[model samples]
Every structure is written in C-alpha cells, then in structure tokens.
Target: MFIVFEGPDGSGTSTQAKILAKNLEKKGLKVFTTAEPSKNILGKVLREALQKKYELSPKAFQLLFFADREQHVQNEVLPALARGEIVICERYNWSSIAFGVSEKVERKFLENLSSSFVEPDHTFFMNISAEKSLERVVLRGEKLEHFETSEKLKIVQEVMLNLAEQSAFTKRSTILNATDSIETIAQNIEMILTPMLFLQNIK
Candidate 1:
C-alpha cells in the first residue's frame, strides 16, 4: 500500500513517517520510506533553491518538482510497490498543489497537473494551526525558507485541509493532530491503520 504523510512544515509528518515505517518493520513486513523533492539530482536542485531562498518563478520551481516526481515514480516508488512492499511517502501530490497555489499559481492548473501522478491510498494530514507550526519550525532551528513564514504557511495549511475535505486522500481522510506528544500522535496513526491492516497488500 502507498501511504502518505503530508502537512505544512513543522507539522512533524517527517517524524511520524519514520515512526510508522519503523513500527511496520517491527511487524516483519517489507517497508520502504521516502520523501518528495528526493535527494536525487532534480530534487537536489529544488532543495538547494528552497533552502537558499533563491528567487525563482513559481512555474520554474513547479517544473523542477515535476521532473523530480516523474523520475521518483519511475525509479523508486513503482519498483518498490511492484515488489509488494509497503511504501511510506512523506509528501503527497496535493503538496504541490498547495505550495503552488499559495505561491500565486492557479489552483486549477496545479490540481490538474498533479492529477496525472499516482495518489496515495491513505494520507494523514498532520493538523496544526499556523502559529503552532511556525513555533515548531523555529524550535527545530533550521534556516527558514521564504515560504516558511506563518502567513504563507497558513495559506498552505488551509489548502491542505480543503483538499482533504474533498477526498483528495483517504475517504475517511485522517487528520492527525501534530501538536500532541510524538508518541501520542504515532498512536493515533496506529489506530487509524488498525482497521486497514488486513487491507494492506504488502509483501
């Protein structure tokens, strides 16, 4: 099964992703974890651009993300899924839509473009307020990117919530509260997965 953990920065999706993968592995199942804007060539460029806060046209950055996703799907995601391994991805196709729309790109265009990519069977939208998210991000001590500001992230967070309501992911679309203790959040995710356990077609 393709499971995704998606949310605005500092929502702890990354941490939850690893926790889930680790716990799943402990169950003796095959598991693979990866994130978008991967560490590949195209991903590297995108990462550096964001980290450096380089001025970039939204279209150009979106194009780079597309390249990274295309190659990532072909080179990594598909092959793993073909093996019947559980794949835990740290972002979703909707992430691009959220980020792009927040950056002034037309939502329809971004949505249609992302629709061509594979979607996750289950997505956990890490729920948190913009102020809380920003506080967490600052606590992490990482250099802030241009869009890391509370104002922009608020827009991004709203877009995620809107998409979730539209069934952009899981019909029951779980919203994991990110402000809780790490273990508590992980437990919530585990509860969400318990019902779907038998449905997992993992090898």
Candidate 2:
C-alpha cells in the first residue's frame, strides 16, 4: 500500500511518516519511506531554487514539481510498490493541489497533470492552525522557505481541509489532529491501520 502524509510546515506530518514507517517495519512489513523533493538531482535543483528564493512563477514551479514527481514515482514509488513494500511518502499529488492553488495555478491543471501517478492507499492530512504551526516553525529557527509563511499556510490548510471533505478522498483520507502529542498521534494512526494490516496479512 502507498500511504502519504501531507501538511503545512511544522505540522509534524514528516515525523509521523517516519514513525509510521518504523511501526510497519516492527510488524515485519517491508516499508519504504520517502519525501519530495527527492534527493535526486532534479529534486535537489528544485529544493535549492526554492531555498534561494528564486522568483519562479506559479506555472514554472508547477512544471518543476511535476517533473520531480514523475521521476520520483517512476524510479522510487513504482519500484517499491512492485516489491510489495508499504511505501510511505511525506508528500504527493495532494501537495500539488494545495501548493499549486496557493500559487494561483488552476487546480484542474494540477489534477490532470498528476492523474498518471498511482493513487495512494491512504492520505493523512495533519490538520493544524496556521498560528500554532507558524509558532512551531519560528521556534525551530530554520531558514524560511517561500511557502512557509502563515498567510500561505493558512490558504494551504484550507485547500487541504476542503479536499479532505471531498468524495475523491472520502474513505481513503484521514485528517489527523496535529495538536496532539507525537505518541498519541502515532498510536492513533497505528490503531486505524492495524486492522488493514491484518487483512493484508490474511490475504
């Protein structure tokens, strides 16, 4: 199964993704964990461009993200899935939907662009308030990326929440409370997934 975790910066989604990977591994499952922009050359270029505050237009950014995602899915996601491993990704197509819209790119365009990729088995959206999330980022003292601001994150949060409510996500998506303790959040996820894991085991 391909599981994806997504949220604004400091929402703890990445942390949860790692914990969940470990949890699955503990169950004797082969788990693969990855994040975008990937560590590969194309992904690295996109990451550096953003960190350098390059003035990329929304269209330009979307193009680069799509390119990186294509390579990532082709080389990493598909291969891992073929090996019957549980693939957990920190971000995926939903990111394009959220961030693309935030950058004024048409949402339809992004959805169409990403339609070729395999759909995730489950998508966990770490829900959190913009103010609280921003506080966490400030406390971390990391260099601010272009989309790390409260204003942009607030919009991203709204987009995610709206998508979570849509029928496209209906039973396949989860909105996790980001305010909870890390252990509690991880336990919640494990509880939700345990039955599914067992079902897969039986098969």
Q: Each model's C-alpha lDDT?
A: 0.85, 0.86
For model 1, the superposed segments whose C-alpha errors exceed 4 Å read 168-172, 201-203
Question: For model 1, how does the per-residue alpha-carbon lDDT over 63-115 read when each residue is reduced to its tens digit?
Answer: 78888999998899989989988899988687888888888888898888788
TM for every model, in the order presented, reads 0.94, 0.95
Model 2 Cα lDDT, one tens digit per residue, 31-66: 989998988888988898778647788889888988
Residue 89 alpha-carbon offset, candidate 2, angstroms: 0.3
Candidate 1, overall lDDT?
0.85
Q: Tell me each candidate's RMSD, in Å, in order.
A: 1.7, 1.5
Clashes of each: 0, 0
Which portions of model 2 show Cα errors greater than 4 Å? 167-169
